[model samples]
Target chain A: MSDSCCDGNARKAQAGDCCAPDGNVMLLSCSGGSNVGQLANQACVELTQEGFGKIFCLAGIGGKLSGFVRSAKDVPRMVVLDGCEVGCAKAIFKEAGTLLRGYVVLTDLGISKNKDFARKREDIDQVKAAAKQASQAQV
Target chain B: MQIKILGPGCPKCHKTEEVVREAVAEAGVQAEVTKVTNTMEIAAAGVFGTPAVIIDGDVKVVGKVPSKEQVKSWLGK
Candidate 1:
């Protein structure tokens, strides 16, 4: 089992592990070079596929694009996903000052990082279930 | 080079990833493809929509997935 990583363990909160309390949240995935990173990607895909929420962009947010930044700034909530514990996803929003609504870690799902970039079908499905669960709990 | 695909794994995101893979093959370039989904991570990457593409860490497409030719052009391959 993993640690609770609550506010008490701020630094312990990996990229996709910390979450905020607002609604209208957006999901951001690390999508790095690992099986779990792809899992995080799949989770957001499933959530968007279900129409539960729309997937937002990280580059636009990172580059500080006016429309992207303004829209995110306006949104009441946002979420970041890190495939692993590297926290690459969280660092992006952290720099933008946009409120992070939620955080999730793919490794927490038991998928480890890897050099292989091939995303598996089962992996995506499992991550989807996790994303739905996370979203339901958030609401 | 950096390759990014937007969308939360919806059909679009998946398709974009496919397109990216195909484009990479067509170009014969060993590019690193990344799929970003975290909201904060996405925000941090500076994207507001999903099913997007980033080439060399630079945003090339967003809001919708582009065609392989489009991706190729974006990559300037």
Candidate 2:
């Protein structure tokens, strides 16, 4: 629903329509039950909105949906964002049998994991920075 | 009939619920529509995305909120 005229007819479009041609790069994020997880999930949404990449559905992959698993396997590049050291995003990739690339962990960036921490703009910036760095490192 | 709208209470999820209710009323079916907010139960129901619909234990929609007409068709009206 980015455009006012977007009546959501493009819901079935390929993820690449929002990202690189053919959707070579995929973004997966952990929406864990913690504040950091929320931050990670929010960052992915913002990143996708900014056209950094298409945010693939992590829950779909976690649910082991065949289409989602197949799509992730087809992506040549992927960024997995985890809110904490628990690495739920990474684990989803592993469970789906897809190779992980451009991984970024919020806790690795010194963000503390807590159940009650407020999601700050600064935290999202930190995750975005780390994600950008990982994408660059992939080059 | 039992209908479960699954999500973490996001806007789109709410919209889906609204549409499901409308569809049920329009179809004139005696259906109980439930909103599932629990993440674990959502996943357990085979919904990997938010704003999904479950009809009688079968997943009928996922990730997107369908129109009233579409929902009614799914309800077999």
Winning candidate number (TM-score): 2
Instruction: State in Å the error of residue A21, model 2.
Output: 4.1
Model 1 agreement with the true structure over A47-138: per-residue lDDT tens digits: 66665565767767787775475456554445567888787777777888866656777777887678777678877776776665665664
Residue range with the least summed lDDT across 10 consecutive positions in model 2 chain A: A1-10
Note the Cα lDDT for every prediction shown.
0.63, 0.71
Tens digit of per-residue lDDT, candidate 2, span A38-138? 89888888887887766768888888775466456555566788888988788888887878889988888888989895899999998987887777776
Query: Which candidate number maximizes lDDT?
Result: 2
Candidate 1 wrongly placed segments (more than 4 Å): A1-25, B1-77
Q: For candidate 1, what is the DockQ?
A: 0.06
